[model samples]
Target: VSQWLKMKGKDPSIVPLLHPPSKEKENVSQLTLEPIYSSFNDWATQFFEEKANGYLACKLCPPSSRTVYGPKTNPSNRSSHVIDKHNLEPPPYLRNRKRVREVKKQKQQTLAETPIFATTEREKQRENIVIVYATNLLSASTLDDPLWRATFGEKLAGMYPQLLKEMTIEYSKNLDKVFFSRAFGPCCLMADGGKDISKHKLLGSCIKANGKIHVHELFNTENEVLDTTWYQKYFSRVITDIESRSNLVVVGITTDNEKSVVAGLKKVVKTNDHLIRIACGPHTMELFLDDLAKNYKPLSEAIKQARNFCVYVRNHKQPLSALKKYQVDVNGNPVKNPLTLVLSNNTRKWSGGFLMISRILRLRSECERLLRNFPDVPRLSWSSLEDARDYLFEFYLQEQILQRDSSNLIHYAFCWRQMGRHKDSIVESLKATNHDTNVLAISQCFVKHQEKMEACRVFDLCCLLWPVPPKTNNHSYFVNATAQLHYLVLRQWKFYQDHADALQLPEEYRGTNENLRLTFLNKAKGQLTMHYEAVELEWRDPQHLFQASQEITEGHLRQTLQPTPNLSVPGISVEDYWRSVACLCPELRFVVRILLACSASEACVERIFSDEGNIHDKIHNRLDPAYSESQVKIKGNFLVERERKLREKDFGFEELEWEEE
Candidate 1:
């Protein structure tokens, strides 16, 4: 006890008093102990019962347990033992003691400091309100409206007009800090141009990083000529800026296949050998739909008549009322919500045309009844409308699938393959019906765009990487794919070798000796062949045993398959499949990352342009370019972060076999 007191920085001389000498204890008789015993008796009685033998037993413990205290024992000692051994609270009378009160006061103070009950900080609440306004495309002046003040009070109402702009600027700076802190990998650039409601020509650019698309920039291009030369210089400047700012490697550029844009990308590709130019898949499909509407005489006439009928129904109330009445029965009960005639927007792609045709077809019977009373209404061509709807329906579905931000080269190739099958079926049916002209037109249109899409060598390489076998029976296609894969692997390997010291290449990857280099190259080739065979086998009959031409054993395949149990399963995405198999295919993993990261469509940029239109509408026409850009950045990045967190929550984190250097 003396040593413990000394170690605790206390006076050791006081230790002897803790266990008083017997002479001092004897001096304290029953008369002196009586007062102390009497004072604790009341408090102790609540938890302990006194027996006839002058011993106290605890009531809380089990009856069989040996817990008894003698009468001569100090009441303080008995109380301390009971409280410490059983983890019990002090008696009610002891609650007012000074020490207990001090402890309770300390606890109250700590609870007061916790943030659980605290309100949001004023500045944070302000920023959140600004984000909500920007994301919903609300006018900045709405912040100061009377309704806002009544709902949120004066402090949070943001009465100042410039508050939105100021808050957006601050948020954008924070986003820049976050973006610059991460190590960038291979990414693609998507750029497009559009006009706002006020006729302000705007160009938007976005970058796909780590499979998430982020808006990079949006600015007015009214001052500059949007020619091929201008576009080339603009792309060069953008690429240089992106590379200078981060480690992102621009592997490809995707844009709509407008004449100027295509010519500009071609020039950019010629100068930058590493970059590939891709035509937007959704845009190409849209053009095909437009062709059907324009070139086919019967379809064109039906669309014209359908559009005229919609305009008439919307303008004249009598026919509209009649249509609504037809929507109900004699009892005037509505089975469903009354759907009005929908007008097609020239700007939007397949949706407008498809919706217009479908609505007209659904209301065909009602319209035929109304025509007897209203002769001015256009005559119905039910057969022509049905054909147009059927043709446009396929492209509409394709457009919806291709416009997804997650859609990569693999999805592009797969969707087009499905479209080709659809076209073939349509052609066969048309042949049976003796509609030779329609058959020829559909075949030629599909082949023309498909050939253009396949012109980019990256598509073929991605298709090869895809687990499913290519749709073609041609052996030459696979041969070319193998050759291209070899070239890509060798190129990546040489790059690693060149930067071996900087990359801190692992022993397996660093081919320092000539023989080591040759061996690695041979192994890469063998692995590629084995992968191709495995893919074919899985596609044809998953249960079939795969036999590699080289020394690869069943154990090796098992090891590769162990990590990716779903690799052979349908509905797995290309990005997921490549990531799962990355560790087993080290050399090809680098190529996969670079090639798969290249987007086949500029749909992301087009969507951003649509958002821009909403932001720059007539009500918010005076929004400055910087303010608009900041709003777009905040809205885009905010949504991306939200979606990422949701994905992580829904399907835990995906294990990546290799991370980019």
Candidate 2:
């Protein structure tokens, strides 16, 4: 190759020998061996990353990739197959005049000289002129808005830096985003007297599109009235800004169960037609505890004790720390939160925030001890605790969670033996009628809360007059009217002739059937009518659920009778069937005549739950996932001294024993 290159007026010394060629005569014999790696133009290139016919055809790998030919390939195998030593493809370029001579000459000369560092006078002047022009055009006042404070924390402190100094920088970072602030639609405001959540205190509203929940957190002040006013101003401003930028509308407002938030939204919307007001169902449910307590004082008192017991276990961690003090189960886990000792799943809320019955029993021993020592610690009285427990026992058995058995008959019997929650619910509703402030709204809530068959007669007539004349009734097809008519039929058919005048079931429908066959058949026809109607619900609807379950039960019973022997059709034992129906549907008892020869057990009903829904469960089974919280240890390793020094009050986390590696 060297001789050939020199003949063509190229560099005589072109190819580099991998090892320095020996000058000794004896080394000439070693040159007889084939090179594992070859070279060109003294350049050290990877043998595996070059293109030439001596290598295999490239697969999916880049074209630059190279390999010696063969199926069994390895790092040590660098041989080109024996047949292809001469039959090869040409490379991209040869060790020639264009590559070696000219390129090498330029590279050597360039490396020998020093690099220039200074810019030309014209270039320097051009950059400085650009900077000066931009400086004069820009205004420093642009930094005054919340935008600057959002991006640059300390450098651009907000107007009220002292007030916001305590809040986290990340919380206020929303102001930095221009895209989010502009070209937006659909903003809703929500406010409540904020409570501290572990590390931070927050006041915010949800402004969103479709289903995206964007939190617009605003600053809050200590002065309660001023705090509310600030939120209102912020909410109103954002709404107006959004409306101007885009054709946006305020659809709904959801607030916590607080009086202040309700009062704030009340200012903007009057009848809830434009701005739909929704309260957190969980919060409204919490208020039920207060109502239940007033109606059945005994149950509330006990629940208080149970809550104190759970809190005490947390406060006095030392007592629960040792394994020997409280024996571990066979699984080596400690007994669950002692709250279960007082509050059973029966009447307990799903979140298990606090229950009256369990609190009483769970706190019994603790209360006695507190009385013996520091009597000043407040707790429920013994008489109140007993009443609370007795009342809650009934609620627990009545609730699907606590009574796991399908035997609503048995569950109801057992629960009723204790006390009925329906009684408390009704009593609470009746008491609201006396309140003059929300006299109308409260009355509406009252009727809905404790619904009864006979009570629904008023709403039936009200439905007839719903759209008066010009507007059509909500009932769309014959199916919808048939559905409503069935409701009317079942109700009218069941009512005693004596009660007919009081109910006023429209004028033509007033007369009672003198013939027993027609009356019974008409009543059966209403039951037999297959009709469907859709209801517009704000959120959760339990009434629909009850109706659905009852429908399925009655349908299945009638279908089962179709194949019976001796009789033309199969039929349920009327007494038992009606009694069982009454047991499940509290509203049906008035017309159904649910008196059973013997009260039915709830076991069948519970088994039926697996088919219908998960409405039946044992006391412990009914407890919400939150109650199981104290059961598991948190995941991930601890962070050394940081986790160790973290006080109990700083965050509601249990202290860990080890540091993360």
Candidate 3:
């Protein structure tokens, strides 16, 4: 090949290309010459040459600063040295190479146009998966799981933070539209706090408006000391912010019987005269039970014995097994999943003390049989347990009634009166049984708490507006409550009337209509006075009240005071009743709406905290506090809307009775 190339007057280097070595020999030759060929090719060959020792020395570089590439060095090293040292343009082939960024852009565009990478449906699926993950408390890392990836595809995985942000914004907007509508009116603020499994102290707040409770804000108060001053300041700011954001007027605040919270609320009420502070009725009743257990020796001893018995059975496997084995029905058939003893914890609001006693009472036969083998267990005082159980059962019913979201001051008053009657009956029963000390102690406890509850003027006023006349025989108390009701109604009416009148007139004409407004106000007062007289008269006579329903006629006083059907039924809604009568008594309806909207207990806020605990559980302990709170708020508002929709869908018919008077 070299001899032929010489005859043709061409360089001998072309001889290798024209007559390449055989396949085996060519592989070896290419491997040996690859480094030399690559280093000298294109741009590098312009300014460098390979030496005997297999180094490519740069020609353009100064002698002292000459750069070289070893045999094992990459071709990029030679090319970089030539271009950088000489500041010369790269060869055509090198210059035409695609850049890293342009290559990446092309790949992305190609992928975007692919069928699998289509976004519309995939994006929706991803959004739904994120919502399910959030609402169901699924772990964010589950997105990366092998099974999840295989089922949902790899495209749906990751991006948790970004997806969560979008969902949070969307749910926040939904919550705003649902809970904070422009028709916002009077609402009560409820606040409570507790520690989650993570030991993070959380304070939750809720607003009750239009007979539904809406979660407002949740704060991580781990660093703040929970004291009267802190609560006062915190609640004050919350109230101010809420009022500023909407047309809602916070007419009252309800909270559990925490000393600092109560003291703080008192301070808030002092500053804001229109606001009333209500102690949670259920919490108060729990305290009442606490008092009874402390003051009554017999009841206290019985409860302690019952608690010890429960602990013994639960801790000792032998007794528990025996009790379960012996558990049977009245027909002597074996039962599956036998009842277990419920241990009472003081930290829990329900106390479960009554539940504990009740369980033991239920498994009495089984317990008695188990006691034969396990004599070391403490014996229960059956009579004393029965007495305590029966007494606490009444309070239990009252607590359940009061804890309802629909419960209001009127319900509180009725429960209070019912408890008073139950207490008296127990005292009389104890007197007949010759238990003098027990009777005296029970009487004192009832009177003390009763006085405390009645001290709040709002309770009495709400009771006076109860659809059914209060069953008290104390005519003097009734007279005083009636007077207070009239005064409160008139005051609220004036405020509402003045606000309405001002809004109706222009700013320039408001001052000039003062005389005309006074005249209108006087006429309205006369009508309100007549309605008050009719309400009071009907309240004193139940027969007359029901009879007046039959005499309804236009422009008649009976029409104004017509008794609503099923008004005394326990299931009847006070808010609904007042709404039914709104046309007949707008002033009365206005006052009742505000009072009824004031929650009687902080159960709704307690429920919010419970949900937060579930969301921020051990598995999700590392969740961001703000994220967890948003989840709880969104979940709660969704439930509220769902319940409202359900209530709207529920319809019923009732038979109406009329009397020919």
Candidate 4:
């Protein structure tokens, strides 16, 4: 070939190397000797150069096997096969470039059969951005501005309504899943009413049994007062509607102590005995604080002085800024105040009295100095401040304790016990401050709280059943516990029996007699016994948990009485701890699940009211009340669902111990 090229007057170097077909077959073994390309550029150039002769190679593939792939020209197809078949990350640039080319090619084909105005990829992406931005900020109309068109183009900017509709539909579907799924099932109902920016009445319900916001609706009462009758009928209707839609029973309803709401709740309970009626524990505590303050002269005088002092600072920004500056100067932290006075207001959820007292006590020295610095500041008598803190410190702490995780069921039994202790503390205070006018008022409120706590036999029963900080499973404890459990079961039985009698169901199915009561009690005791045993055994040997024998009760009792903290227990949450130990005590799983679903207070619903104010603020004021409801519901439930997903991913639901024979 070189001799022929020389005779033709062309340089021999210009001639392309051409291997004979027979020689190519001989050289196939040598072709497999090339090293694997580290990147796309090397692989693409080398492969295509070789492909000029209609050959394909895969250096990474075993040479003993077919180390070659295809005469594949499509980079995407080649990269995809390499990744799938060889389990490798294909080069990014080549894969992305190939993907973009394929997409454009498909787009061209699509455009050929469509109108010229068909939305392009860039327009679709811009439309998606606008939709997401609008949905997040609740600012749908912002996209309608002419300024947005310059950046997003008219076609994309104009699609905001469609984008919003799609988002609403997606959000609705998610909410539907939350409502219908067992994961969000059988929740406590927390409902409250608040006005929006336009003073439009909004009533929202948060189902905390499964830690998901199930319903948040706006009531179009149209400038009318929501009286007792309205609340009664509305609550019943809402509960029924939610139950029907979600297929999840409302275990209980919690509300603040408005006389109308209290009376309305009574009506709800009258119709549904299965539904427990609970006054918001936090709200009740707030009332207790108010009653104490009213009855106690010194405390009332102290609060009056504190309120005036706060008013002077708050209404005057200069004084407030001076106070903050004093806090920073004294503490050596300019950016953060050691403590900023939180003005106590009647409307605050955690009573303003508690906040005022807590802050005053914490920063008593600084506050006194600040008062002196600002001569205009109201002089709170030192005796008044000291006397009020002395009298109200216990009450403040109790209120704070009850308010803790008010939306969590795990703390309900604990809160109930704490309330009893608080009553005792109040009684002690009543005696200590015998001359104070507030003593009688505090005593009266304490008596009422004591009676309420005492009436709920189930609260005591739940306390007996709680797993952590183990109880002595003694003969006396068991006997008393059994009696309490029996009382609760019988009450539940009577409730169901009355319902059956009222409905007059088929005679065979309606049999709710002493036998049914006995059966329930027996099951309850058995489950409790097994649960106690399982919890004890779990600490000893979790691996062989199911093998734990009930006959080893005495040994289990001793262990439970003196639970040793291991490396795992401290980090584990109450839910996770129960979830872990539940398998060993399988019969008690459902009982624990129910207890966990209960909320101590209706704070979750109250949180929605605050959220609604933010969502329907001036910038987002045009949001329809219904739309606002949807947004808040999705926001709250999405957070809970996300946590649930992460928990499930880490420690799955499949670990639940099922009931054994």
Q: Where in model 2 is the C-alpha error above 4 Å?
A: 1-189, 195-202, 227-234, 241-248, 271-273, 320-353, 359-386, 393-421, 424-661
Off by over 4 Å in 1: 1-174, 293-295, 311-351, 366-377, 390-415, 431-441, 452-661
lDDT value for candidate 4? 0.47
TM-score of each: 0.45, 0.33, 0.45, 0.47
Off by over 4 Å in 4: 1-174, 181-185, 328-331, 334-337, 341-350, 395-399, 402-419, 422-434, 453-661
Q: Candidate 1, overall lDDT? A: 0.51
Per-residue lDDT of 1-661 in model 1, one digit per residue for the tens? 5677889999988755565557545532222211122334455566788887899888877999957889888777666666788776664556457377689999867654433212447445544443222111111111222222222333432343222223334545655456545626555676766444445566766555432344456557878888999888989988997888887667668787789988987888778755666666556656666675555566566667777777777778888777777776568686365655334232144435555667766777777888888898767778878876665444534343323322233344445555665776766655665332466776778777765544332333333443222233332222222223323432344444554454344577675433444444445444543444334324323122111111233244344433332334444443434433342365344333332333202232233224342211211112222234444453345444544554465342342321110
Query: Candidate 4 has which clashing residue pairs, if any?
Result: 295-437, 295-438, 296-438, 409-598, 583-657
Q: Whole-model lDDT, candidate 2?
A: 0.35
Ranking by TM-score: 4, 3, 1, 2
Candidate 3 TM-score to native:
0.45
lDDT of 3 at 281: 53
- Window of ten residues with lowest summed lDDT in model 3: 134-143
Candidate 1 residue-wise lDDT at 310? 72
Model 2, residue 601: displacement in angstroms? 53
Candidate 4, residues 386-455: lDDT per residue as tens digits? 6666665544353444323332322333354455556667567657664556555677877765434332
Query: In candidate 2, residue 114 scores what lDDT?
Result: 16
